[model samples]
Target: MKIAVIVQDGFEAFGLGVLTEVWNEPYHPEDDNPVFDFVVCTPRPGRVKGPAYDLFVDHGLEATEDADMVAVTAKRDIASPSPEVAEALRTASARGAQIFSSCSGAFILGEAGLLDGRECTTHWRYAERLQAAFPLAKVNPDVLYVDDGNILTGAGSAGGIDASLYLMRRLYGAKTAATAARRIVVPPRRDGGQQQFVRTPLGQTEADTLAPLLQWASERLDEQLSVERLAAEAHMSPRTFARRFRDETGTTPLQWLTSQRLALAEELLENSTLPVEQIATRVGFANAAAFRHHFAATRGSSPQAYRKTFSCCEEETAEQAV
Candidate 1:
């Protein structure tokens, strides 16, 4: 694949590093791994001062025209992108080339009109501004990245890594992406969303206040817990507790409990040789059927399939026996 990383003055170093790690780093080349023709392109093509260092790019804006993917690295400035760079990005998009942006680079994509009506994301800090600046864009603040067809927008630093791997997975396959991830010592896939990192001081304070109650709930995922019971434990009325839970966790109490239970179920499925029925009961599901239904709905695979794919006790499964 021909990939062009568009850089500018004050470019973010970590974002570029992620691109290099995924596309440029050599690993198991003899195993028929995908090779990318990666190039760093800038508007001026000479010495450009980034946040960390002044580097020389050999190519200019025109290089993007021939690339299968044009990636815009984040800039510290987050100022309006130069017309020349914006034009190059728009041209690449018009020609069906995949367009990508890391962190604040989504602002540049916004300038190119590529994010119009598209669900996109940026760093949590910039999500509100990105939405205000590009009113037509649906800016989802709680995701690591947004893959809206040809245009992919990543959130903060690590989000760029996830976005790049996602593109690789989409273009190649999970196994191929896993090879690249393994080479870098990163998980082939990460669970949960970026909601885990959002910084809300008020939320944090509320969470701290409810910490003991939450810990108690976490330990009893096997129990069919209710909001009323949790509320009583917190010494607050049910309505007040429900509202506080949403304010603090960004999700309803039920949703949070379900997530906790599902997470435990995944752990047990991967590590234990227990039957599905037992695992379901251990994770607070009403029955094996309900567990199977929710597991498939949330994980896109049955518990048995998940175990087959990730079971640590390999010798205990039917496949291993066979």
Candidate 2:
């Protein structure tokens, strides 16, 4: 497949490097895999200046017209998307070609109207902005990437690498993607989602927020802790507690609790051999059916499938070298 990476002035060098590194290799006997045909294109097809350097590109947006995948590289200026670039992306999309954007490059896709009514994601920092700019699109700020059919959106450079490997796995096979990832020294997959990566605090007022309650709740996810119960625990009424919870966590009580439960479920699935039913009860999901429903809704995969991909031995092998 021909993969065209489109860039503009002040484009992110790391994003371009990631796409090139992942897709622009030749067949290697050691890896025993074939790579995609890759080319870098831009609006002007000349020297493209990045934040720290410049790169001369001989190809123009026309390179994307017939490419199987058009990767829009994030640029410093997402406010204005070139008409030629949008045309190239639309051309690719209209032909059923896969279109991808790394980080804020999703704004370019939004400008082209490709993200309308589709599930997508970007770095958590820009998720709100992306949604404000394109209200019709469903922006998921918590996932590392969203593979909504032909249009794919990745969070950051690391998420870009993960999504690229996932695409490789989808097109080729697990062994092929693993080989490619090994060649680059990255994990074959990162399935914990982007929730943990959101370390930025909401504001200075967070110091007075419900940190104690949240910590306590997180530790007891295996127990039934409803809003009323939590409200009494925090010495606030249910309505007041719910309001305060949203103000502090930027989500509702149920949403926050579900997210915490899902995080715990992920850990259990990755590091334990418990059956799905037992794991569900362990995570306070009421039953396996409810757990499966929420897990698939948020993580986009079944618990069993996630375990199959990320499960590992709980303890180090006795005979293995440390």
- Per-model TM-score, in order, reads 0.70, 0.66
Summarize candidate 1's per-residue lDDT along 204-285 as a digit string, tens digits. Answer: 5665777788899999988979999999999999999988777676777887887788778877877788889999999998
Shift in Å, residue 50, candidate 2: 1.3
What TM-score should be assigned to candidate 2? 0.66
Give Cα-based local distance difference scores for all models. 0.84, 0.83
On residues 1-322, what C-alpha lDDT tens digit does candidate 2 reach at each position?
Answer: 8999998998998999899888998888776788678899888888998999999999988899889999999999878757888888898999999999879999999999999999999888899999999999999988788898799899976789988987887777556777889999997766525352433355666535688898899889889998999999899999988877766665678888888788788767766677789989998999999999999997778987876665553233222325
265: Cα error in model 2, Å: 14
Q: In lDDT terms, how accurate is model 1? A: 0.84
Which lDDT value does model 2 have at 25?
A: 81
On lDDT, the candidate that comes out on top is: 1
Superposed model 2: Cα runs more than 4 Å off: 200-322
Model 1 clash pairs are none
